[model samples]
Target: MATVELRFSAQPEHVRTARLVAAAVARRAGVDEAVLDEVRLAVGEACSRAVGLHRSHGIDAPVHVVLTEEEKLFSIEVGDEVPGSGGGASAVPGVRASGADDGDDGAEDEMGLAVISGLVDDVEVTSGESGGVIRMSWPTTPATVLP
Candidate 1:
């Protein structure tokens, strides 16, 4: 497997840089053109979400992106530190709390999650020693085989 990692301040402008780097890595991994587009958009959305969370919480930390190319899959992980929380709080407006017990309502729209889910084959969200993580992966096609 080959991996590429990028780290930058959680600023709005930096989201575009993340997208570009993700696209370049996906392209180098032989991802399909259609899938490449999806990867770019997903990376942008993930980075944007992280940036918003950091800004809202007044946390000045870097957002980290890691792209890995394996024999059968291409994966991307976007992570950032969430302030005051153990990185488990939901930052996206419409996402349901990871493990909420509130009986009020589960009416959150989760459009961002929906979009990410639609684009990638698999997605996992978690809080870890590093921070909040959004990991997405797509299966590589036979055409994506390395020469």
Candidate 2:
């Protein structure tokens, strides 16, 4: 397994950068086209959510993005500090993706958590002391293989 760590501002534009980073990891893992596309979308949504809800003593802090790849599986972890500094409410986590098993692409665009869950085979949403983390994973099956 290989890991790539990134620390960047939770800015709006950084969302795209985070997605690109995740996509590169997918490519390194040899993920298939379909799975890679899903991974890219899921990770992008996860990071964007983290950045959007980020709170840091009334100041926006950088979001930490961790990308991991093991064999045909890729995982993305997005974490950030709540702007309120660190409090119970600040600990309130944001949504992960759209929803699981909801193949409706439109739903994905509508729901944040649903989109991530729909794209990834596995997803874990956890809260941190200051912010939260979203972990998303998808199988990198080769396109040449049959489902």
Candidate 3:
């Protein structure tokens, strides 16, 4: 397996950089064009959410995006520094709180977690020693053998 990691300030503009890097890595891993699009969007959403959460909590740490290429799958993890209080709510203008009973909150309307869940094969959110993380993975296309 190979891994590519990028770390940048938790700023909104950096989200685009994360998406581009994810697409480049997916392409390098022989991901299909259709799935490439999904990877791009999913990475963007994950990065945006992390950045938003960090900013909301007034955290000045950088966000980390890591892409891993394996034999049969490609995985991406976006993480942000843990807030001082151990938890922080998103205050980004368009992002909605992640919860089932939060009422619409426009989460479905916008490219939030809901959209990421649909675009990627697997999506997971968790908090760890470093911070909160959004993990996404997709199956890779089988390598074609030349006759």
Candidate 4:
């Protein structure tokens, strides 16, 4: 089994750490260089969304990243603190609302979750319920990247 774990702040600067961690994992998994870059980009976009949506109710929460390489696919799970610290009312992160699909200058310049969905074979978003996790995965098969 091949897996990598990383922890970083929810701040923007820390997103780079997440990206680096992802790239490292992909490389270690023997993923194609081109496919590796795509994974890194998708990881950054997803983690950034998670950071933006984390609840800021006086609780300092670090983003958690887990990359697991299965025989057929690579899975990435990014998790954040839930509302009320995984208790009381459920709070979902709002990063999807800030997607790059909006008709704005910033949106036009950056690739958002929509692009992420396009690049990967599978993408999933799950709000922390009693502290749940959001995960994304893609097939490692070379044909997945073919034109």
Scored by TM-score, the top model is 3
Off-target runs (Cα >4 Å) in candidate 3 are 83-111, 143-147
Clashing pairs in 4: 128-132
lDDT score, candidate 4, position 118: 79
lDDT of 1 by residue, 36-118 (tens): 88999898877876776676566788888999998878899988786322223344344443223693433321445567778
- Whole-model lDDT, candidate 1? 0.73
Q: What is the lDDT of residue 18 in candidate 2?
A: 82
Off by over 4 Å in 2: 55-57, 83-110, 141-147
RMSD of each: 6.3, 8.1, 5.5, 7.1
Best by lDDT: 3
Descending-lDDT candidate ranking: 3, 1, 2, 4
Candidate 4: global Cα-lDDT? 0.65
lDDT of candidate model 3 versus the reference: 0.74
Residue-level lDDT for 6 in candidate 1: 92
Q: Would you list the clashing residue pairs of candidate 3? A: none
Report the lDDT tens digits of candidate 3 across residue range 116-146.
Answer: 7777768887775667777888888876776
| Candidate 2 residue lDDT tens string, 52-138 | 555223445678888887767777787756533122222335422223355453233236666776767688776656666777776
- lDDT (Cα, tens digit) per residue for candidate 4, span 1-147: 438888787787888888988888777665777788888888887777556555333336777889998876788987766542221122323222333356353332124556677787777755544443557776665435437
lDDT of each: 0.73, 0.65, 0.74, 0.65
Model 1: residues >4 Å from true position, as ranges?
Answer: 83-109, 142-147
